[model samples]
Target: MRTEETPLGRKRRARKINRVLAETYPYAVAELDFRNPFELLVATVLSAQTTDVRVNAITPALFAAYPDPLAMSQAAPEALQELIRSTGFFRAKANSLLALSTRIVDEYDGVVPGRLEDLVTLAGVGRKTANVVLGNAFGVPGITVDTHFIRLARRFGWTNETDPVKIEHAVGELFEPSDWTMLSHRVVFHGRRICLARKPACGACPLTTLCPAYGEGETDAAKAAKLLKYELAPGREELLKKMRAGATRAELRTEGYGLQA
Candidate 1:
């Protein structure tokens, strides 16, 4: 099939995808549990390859002991590793966190800098982390291109490049700055629940009509069958049923349920 490449065609597809995603996940927001900029910075660093649930579980204890940059700066590397070991990459993550905390304490007066330029200067804080902190904690406009966002952007034909900077620029140019945070959240929600990396259920996906990669579903039959073997938990089933029965996405999130479909 011929793919969409023209500017008008791309814009139309993006607009439709964005509108449906916004409606599908009206309450989309950050899944990481954090109360402040520092906590968010720490959580984002810990969430490198870990699930939000896992990060959330670990942070309560981690933050309770080292509540701020000053406290965390003085934390022993081994002790910090023990606390976040479950998130994987313990040694590297621990060192990064320690260095980040020390820099924040000594340089920024123990405060997470709101500016992207300054935030990216911290250890382990890349463009994605900087954008997350800016958008979520400081209310600044930023487009965070995480794995989900990148996958969905490519799937939807927003950009053909694999480099994140190009993808960020493409998306940033397409959508208004004000929509950056909300758009990122919505795209992430859709990616996690529908536009998954493997065996995306495009038939039921809200953005399938607008997505160029919709027909690429189930390229591997073995993986597709394996996906079917994993069923949602009883609680998750109840939550999906409730959502189908007219519960708002916000209400479901408030009740501690994530979008699974």
Candidate 2:
């Protein structure tokens, strides 16, 4: 069995993993496209139990039709349901969107509330959604403990707790507040690209040396490379070539890639 690290050792390892993630995904961010907090909030809600790409596919038309809370609040329920039908749970999601939009208009005067307390008070909003809005929209740093983040956290030996709030607090103690939001993005990116849910590309992972669950997935370079996604995949071979040429571990570490030791 793998031995657990001391508290300080765990903290050091967590920061190191985060640092490598920072280099691997220098510009990592939400895949869901949106122009404003309201759009992000709506898109994120639609994103539940669905892919971000799917959410992005539908949002342009959705946003064009209901550009703001007041407009969204007044949207015809059937029309709204049809528009978001592809995202799944159309009726319930539609109800949430309309109810939340109505709340935003009636209570917050059409502006999506900036405060976490206020944001969560809106219908269908939760801590995760609130964190996404706060971090991306308001520039407030927050740890979004999504499935990806949660999985990576445990794999990297950061936290054992499955409860999102507990996971958030546990991992939160490892980094500076300013790092929380980007940290979430990087971790999520790594989870999707390398440390995947079913079969992780462990052999191609830059952090395999630091990851506690290193051998849990495909550990052959040829096979592992086949498992990469998006820009890290065969379609982006040229970009991967360029990234490999320049992004060395030493170079990445020099760019504040890992935690201070």
Candidate 3:
């Protein structure tokens, strides 16, 4: 941040950046595939130090065997551990899951609590995990200060706080509480797809004029475009364009749209 920047200046800048991010990634949401609060809680717990894609891959079988708190609470330790083995730290994660599930069943009647206070009391559930569950599952708003969020928060000059709790509170003051959850998604999406840590696609970014760290990454349009990574990948927009032009899935697949590694 420059010496001339005020708290008000930072606040306005933060909101503006989020507006651009919201427009750029309108489809952003929790990447973890889950149907209910219990599933989301379980997925979030397993997501520590791992990618959502990896967690999503294993949840199907894990859920198939133990779909709820009561069932999961009764799962054999080894069986539960094996189900989530791919997410790494399987033993510790299994312990958390078992402990939390048992607590939920015994205390909360097998239902995931919606309030942050209660949610954080469960094993393996911290503020980040609690916020994710509250925002996505219960429609309660919260800021989730994960790694991506933390990195982007500082880059955006939203806050200087290094602590997750402080970062969450600091950034939370910049936008309305209602914007908290979606703002988190948008910031994380931008971090993952554009304002990356090592090689942000600066020239391809929508917020180039607003970003203070504009020249920190690739600046040439062509080079920055190549640096872009997204769920749609480079082929996503092309596929969407062709689809909008009336291309069918089978036809698109034949055209190699879904064949990327």
Top lDDT model: 3
Relative to the true structure, how large is the alpha-carbon lDDT of every model? 0.81, 0.86, 0.87
| TM-scores of all candidate predictions against the true structure | 0.86, 0.90, 0.90
Better of 1 and 2 by lDDT: 2
Tens-place lDDT digits, model 1, residues 187-207: 887777666687686555655
Question: In candidate 2, how many clashes are counted?
Answer: 1
What residue pairs are clashing in model 2? 19-257
RMSD of each candidate? 4.0, 7.1, 3.5
lDDT of 2 by residue, 1-261 (tens): 258578888878788888888888875777677789999999999999988877877888999999999999999999999999999999999999999999998888899999999988887889999999999999999999899999999988888899999999999999989999999999998888889999999989999789889999999999999998866875665555544565543344355433111
Candidate 3 residues lying further than 4 Å off, grouped into runs, are: 239-261
Question: Candidate 2, which ten residues in sequence have the lowest lDDT sum?
Answer: 252-261
Best by TM-score: 3
- Candidate ranking under lDDT, highest first, comes to 3, 2, 1
Clashes (candidate 3): 0
Can you list the residue pairs that collide in candidate 1? none
- Model 3: worst 10 consecutive residues (lDDT sum): 252-261
Summarize candidate 3's per-residue lDDT along 177-231 as a digit string, tens digits.
Answer: 9999999999988888888888888888899877787888999998888877754
Query: 1 or 3: which has the higher lDDT?
Result: 3
